[model samples]
Target: MKKTTLATLSLAMLGATGAAHAQNSVTLYGIVDTGLTFIHNDGGNGNSYSMSSGNMSGNRFGLKGTEDLGGGLKTIFVLENGFNSTNGKLGQGSRMFGRQAYIGLTGDTWGTVTAGRQYDPLVDLVQPVQGDNWLGGIFSTPGDIDNADNSARVNNSIKYTSPVWAGFQFEGMYSLGGVAGATGSGQSYAGAASYSFGQMNLAAGYYHLSNGNTLAARLAGTTTWDSLFNTSVNAAYQSASSINNARIGGNYTFGPVTAGGYYSYAEYTADGRSLFTRAQKYNTGSVYAMWQVSAPLQAEAGYTYMHSTGNSSAKYNQFALAADYLLSKRTDVYAQVAYALASGTEDPAGGQAQAVIGSATGDSGSNKQALVTVGIRHKF
Candidate 1:
């Protein structure tokens, strides 16, 4: 009798543990995107072809989980890592969980709050209604001056997302510099809101960041600023001490077609240690149309215009077209082409502006540039 009772107790304990485990859920997800790319006039070397990674979307693997805590509240966490599929190397400066890492709690009646490395509010809200949602960075601003490509991610951030109410939602974020004695130095903040009514959607946001007072703090290789001006389009303003960006966008869907446009203004503030003494301002406008040709096929066409003043007077015009075909629910193939033309003197070299299709290709070394890519993407 004693032996039988002990076995029964063990079985009951195992059953209780299993029931508790069932209340928690975890998921592993990843995407692999690779492509063959061709660029005309790449860094003055005419006609270059190479295998590229992340033409459509960055390659990444992530784990997300939620634990039910009763009372309609849950604890959530996510760890995402980015990599280069072509070279089999880590991306986002080789951090283990470079893309995102956050933990927080959510409730039915209240909003969600998370803390850790994260994308700013503008990228979380406004980018969804922009052309880059379908065609990737090739459809973004010339150099992604306003972070349309999500080139910059904030570290040590605390974010709040409001639950949707009456088809409207909002998000706000602030990143801590972690500097002792200086609370505002190297800080970043953003706020954004979006509304959806029927087939129409609208979004707007603002972002600001301080690069610290020292020259070394604003340089590219550091953790404080991590400049996104890798391309020639805005490299001349890399020494800026602060950056401010404001953007607005909206889109409408009618039957199988969707159309949208966006405008952004970005300003780079200069200081005594900067390369340029005057503040640089950039204005960008873009419009796009996407067509769902069939259940499995889609096409998009977009145009962008960017003008810069203050440091130099320049203009950039870019045209892009792309098509994607879904082979399965989790697999797709795509082709994209873009051409860019630049005018006026924007180069610190005192020469005419060089066209760069997007952040993907190198400087054209001239006034015109073009890019073409055919890629495959798979999600698991």
Candidate 2:
């Protein structure tokens, strides 16, 4: 943690020294999210109640700035850090700028390009229309198997995004593998696009990631997947050679109600180092409807179903409900409940049927689990 603090201080000092330009501006911003949560069947054996952090949204602080250069060009940067309000410890492996750290250039006619650690195209363009964006991970995919909870990040990445035209925009990203004599090892890449027409929105994207393994080609240690497979849901696929995901989503607004849904298909392909003999696959579907009952209050209901094939056969059914009240433009309070039922075979290395309502601790020992939480979020 001390190492992260020093890195943060150095970056802040450097930014402060360059804040004298008239056309440059830097702003500090953050979100503090905390809540009380109750779980029926945590780790599949016992019920628990605890104070939690970032159940609705991640707790984070960040510095972002833009400097206008001549000829309609600008320099932009963002340095964001994630933390846990409960323990005052760092998130995302205790990196100083774990959430994001990037510098880039934008132009009037050309597209934008950024380099550093960042979210992939699917998370950037396809997630906004998803239910998780409205009520957080409680409304997300099971085990976040499809990354609907935004748990993955790409390091050593370069991203490009085009300006919106006729309400259409597209993006692409690539993360390099910094191993010597191995250009393609441990690489990750993605592409996505979105279009808006009146009150309707649609998006699609694909992501591919190669596991970091030196025995295959060579050790390309640049790309780090954050160990998303370290959970009970998809643990057996940890030794897979590669992971691929394809997603599509759309949303429509009618009067005071908004409806949306998304579909995702993810495949885990094995290599010689894999645990399973064949490829493992997951198919997930989700939909939600949000109603604006009043000016300051809104409610939502959602449903999700997931199925597994190949290495193991499994099934999961989830239902969720939520309500949000706005205290101010930058503050909100929310309450949500999620219930899940699972049945099927295990992933060998994975645990019994488990759930990830608000935490990734472990799975429910039985075939069912429920989670309830209420929280407050403030942004500045």
Candidate 2 regions with alpha-carbon error over 4 angstroms: 1-22, 215-222, 349-351, 358-362
Off by over 4 Å in 1: 1-22, 220-226, 347-349
With candidate 1 superimposed using the best TM-score fit, by how many Å does residue 380's alpha carbon deviate from the native? Answer: 1.2
Per-prediction TM-score to the true structure, in the order listed: 0.93, 0.91
Tens digits of per-residue lDDT for model 2, 204-272: 999998876643332332354555664567877767788899999999999999999999999988877
Worst 10 residues of 1 by lDDT: 1-10
> Top TM-score: which candidate number?
1
Point to the candidate with the largest lDDT.
1
- Angstrom error of the Cα, residue 254, model 2: value is 0.5
Tens-place lDDT digits, model 1, residues 1-380 = 00111111122334555644325666778889999999988889888999999888889988787767667888888888999999989998898999999999998879899998888888888999989888678889887777877887888899999999999999999888877887887888889999999999999999888877677767743433346777788888877888999999999999999999899999999989888888889899999999999999999999999999887889999999999999988889999999999999785566688897755676888899999999999988
Worst 10 residues of 2 by lDDT: 1-10
